[model samples]
Target: MTTILLVDSHDDARRTLATALGKLRSDWTIAQADSGLAAMSQMDDKSATGHVDVIITESQLVDMEGVTLLDQVRSSAQQPLRFTLSSNSEAEAVLANSRANQRFLLKPVSAEQLANIIERSMRLQHALNEERLNLYMSTVNAVPSVPAIYDEMMKELASAHSSLIKVASITESDTGLTVTVLKIVNSAFYGLSNRVESVGQAVTLLGVHLIKNITLTTKVFARFKGSKLSARRLTQLNDEAMRIGALANQFARLAKLSRSTTDHCQIAGMMANVGELIATSKAESDDGQPSLSIEIIGARLLDSWLMPYAVVEAVALQHESPPRNVDMLSPLVVLHSIRYLQKTFTDTTDDQQRTLCHEYLAQLVPPAVAEDWMDAFHAIEQLTAAKPPRAA
Candidate 1:
């Protein structure tokens, strides 16, 4: 049975929430704690397996604040999914305590909403290789933190009337981020008529969602700076990401997928090599390198940063072998096809290898469409190669 700890200062509220959660799922075992110390004791108890699957607590507890309690849980070896049921007004505290693996639920949450988030989180947890995720995160010197700009962008996105100007304004706070955004906006991928002079102009042209993703992507690259990977190696990986991202976006369009889907495919492509980047960074000595699955590490990093689920799924499964049951032009399919084609196109001049690549694409799409996708990809590659290097 999945055990959940419901911690609250008020005994009645704790019991009431436990009852409601229990009613939602009979298989669940709910435990109530009235203080942070009690919650900690419950976590360390032997009969409870020394951990619970989820911890739901109020912002105000008898002993300590919820954020502090959650922080302790986060830093512990036991990585239970965390949620905070607090007043909607404490958005800042919620954001402070929350990580990629945790969520903040406003107070007065209904049973249905609670059940829905719990079930979704459980499914995500099961889908992920949890043990491996914990091991990798524990060892990494620096897993990127969620940037403040990302939170601001999320707020703008969630607002009833979000303005492009406002979103752009948030980027102004970070000169490095603003420069990166403009560089990508004016990159060969977009093929804009004129160079973008400011973040506002880029946001208006690229759309807020895409700009938001770009901000997050750029922030991660900036944050993970002190790695052991050589500058040449890092640049090579980044160039490949750009190539894959441009090709994936073009492929998505050729498949007639939605704009949002295309953007996701692009972001996934840019992030596809993140696991390798992290692994290379975490290497103990330059004499030898650690061997780790890039996809799993990338997936765990994204999940920890609270990126969109679709983006995480695409990155995590990018290197998966064929025999997947997914939409023909889905982000995952597009990314896989693009990556396969990219490697095939680069590493092989043999006719047999080319034919094999075609077969792979045909497995994902019609032969005619596959050919057209390759043609578009080739065009983008040539165009990007001709462009001068983007300022770092």
Candidate 2:
């Protein structure tokens, strides 16, 4: 049976969540601890009995913060999925400490919301194991806790006094980052009719939130130049990432998803292939393919960089379909659709390809979005085609 551990300082909140979860997932066993130390003890007690499936905790514990407790749990051989509860004020701190695939829930979460998110987290854990992804993730070097410029940008955005112009100025100060961001905006993935020559222009077209994400992913790619992969191959991977990201953004915009959601869709799209940098470096020499998946590797690295949970989940599940649910507008779905489009268009069959493309769009998106989907796709195609290719 599935097992879950709930950790919270408040007795009432802990019991409430445990009771609700028990009702929602009657077959699963539910356990609770009043503090981080006790939670670790509970994990130790359950280690031999298949460990815990999920750990749900409040941000503040008597002895330590939720993320610190989960970090300790993660360092152990057992890898239970982690979720932390936080008020809006503690969001930045939680994001900093949250593991690559761990999730965060806001305060006052409803019973139905908690139940559903936990169920999804459990389902995600199964998907990770079944795919044998994350099996070799430990072998990969951890990405930096967070890149400098990206961290600064996040802080600026969080401040009420910060403005887009200020963030753009910060991005402009980094020449390499500025060039990379402009390249992406000018590339086919962004699909703009007019060329964007500067960081300010690009930020004008795409929001600052997205530009910051782009900067982070680009910096990671730049760091990989010293890796085992050849310069040419790294370039190809970067190109692929850009294409996927652009397509995912188009899909989100066409579907009228929220601006925040759209930004995550692009971030997930851009970073989905990150694990390949490690996988190819270490595992390519082996005869058979490694059981580990690049998606998990990428997700973990992104998490280490303190990317939001939405971006991490989208990247992790990009290659796997979550169980069908009422929420069709999820970033994961957007990433999946983009991947499908890339695969279907792999061959250049003129007529047959067109028909297949139309069919895929119609079936993948809701009826309400079908018309806008075509418009969005064509606009992106034209925008990308107009730009001259750049060396990867």
Candidate 3:
């Protein structure tokens, strides 16, 4: 049985949410508190039965901010999944503390939307063994925290008067990130005629959305730079990630997906191989495989870093066979197709894998269209290969 704590200063609002939640999940025990202090008291009360599995709180509590309550709960031995209901005025503050395990719900949330969020979070939680993941992370001794610069850049981008200069400024704050951005923008993959010297120029050329993804990709790889993984292996992995990200971006545009979804696709593609990085670093020898699957490890890492649920989902399902009857193209579908094609075309020995890829393609498009997609894939591969190699 799950226990959910509902905290809101307004008596009516708390009761309303609790009633709706109880109706939605009869088995879940609903607890309520009028203020932050009251909520902490209830959690601290040893006599209280049933550990809280989730907490949904108002942005503004009578005694303190919802973020404060979240921070305290996170510091405790039991870190339950957290949700905050905030209006536009409070979103910045609420988002500042957001994590993969925490969710933000806009005010006036519908019962159905709330239920869906809870169910999704619960499903993700159940997908991996927390103790094992934590143990592996600790053993690696290089667990990455959410990048603060990425958060700041997101806040800037979300502003009504978002400025490219401001985004450049954020990028410039990190010397390593600025260098990475410039190197990538000047790389043959982009095919720029002139050299780009500054972050501002790179931002102007690449736009904020693309720059944001580049920054995230750089930060993620930077975390494991000095780990057990060999430099050659790491470089190969980074190159492959860059190729996948570029392909994902092109596919998203070809499919005419929304700007937000396109960004998600690119980032998800770049991050899909992160699990392999961890596995490679943790293995006793270069030839050994990881104890855990790369997809699960990558998903867990991204989830912890507060990446969008869609991005996390795409990375998590990268290795799985494509779902049947997918009429619409999505980041997951695109990533799966890319991975499948890479395997099918590059490794002709794997007849079973090739057959599976063929069957999956047939479900998505006609044979002719599928053939065209393969051609497009080769074009992308050729373009990616033309890029200048990273310095040793």
Point to the candidate with the largest TM-score: 2
For 1-392, candidate 2 gives per-residue lDDT tens digits of 88888898999878987898888879888888999999888778765445787887777789996767887887876777777776654553324323432566656677667677677656645654553555465544534446788778877875657688999999999887888788777766654799998888777887786788788778778877876678888888887677667777778887877565677788888888887876787654443455656787777667656565667778888766555542446677788766655666544345687567667656656755755655555565555567634423
Off by over 4 Å in 1: 1-124, 127-129, 284-291, 322-324, 347-355
Candidate whose lDDT is highest: 3
How do the residues 1-392 of candidate 3 rate in per-residue lDDT, one tens digit apiece?
Answer: 88888999999978988899889889888899999998888888745736887888887788997878987887876667777766644563335324422555556667666776676667777775477777776666455776778889887875667788999999998887887888877776565789999988887776677788888888878888878788878888887777788778876776666666677788888898898888877674455665677888888888777675567778988867655634445677778878888877664345675566666676766655555566566676666656534622
> Alpha-carbon error at 332 in model 2, in Å?
0.8
TM-scores of the candidates in the order shown:
0.65, 0.70, 0.67
Two-way TM-score contest, 2 vs 3, winner:
2
Q: List the residue pairs that clash in candidate 2.
A: 188-384
Candidate 2, run of 10 with poorest lDDT = 92-101
Better of 1 and 2 by TM-score: 2
Sort all candidates by lDDT, best to worst: 3, 1, 2
Ranking by TM-score: 2, 3, 1
Which ten residues in a row are the worst by lDDT in model 1?
92-101
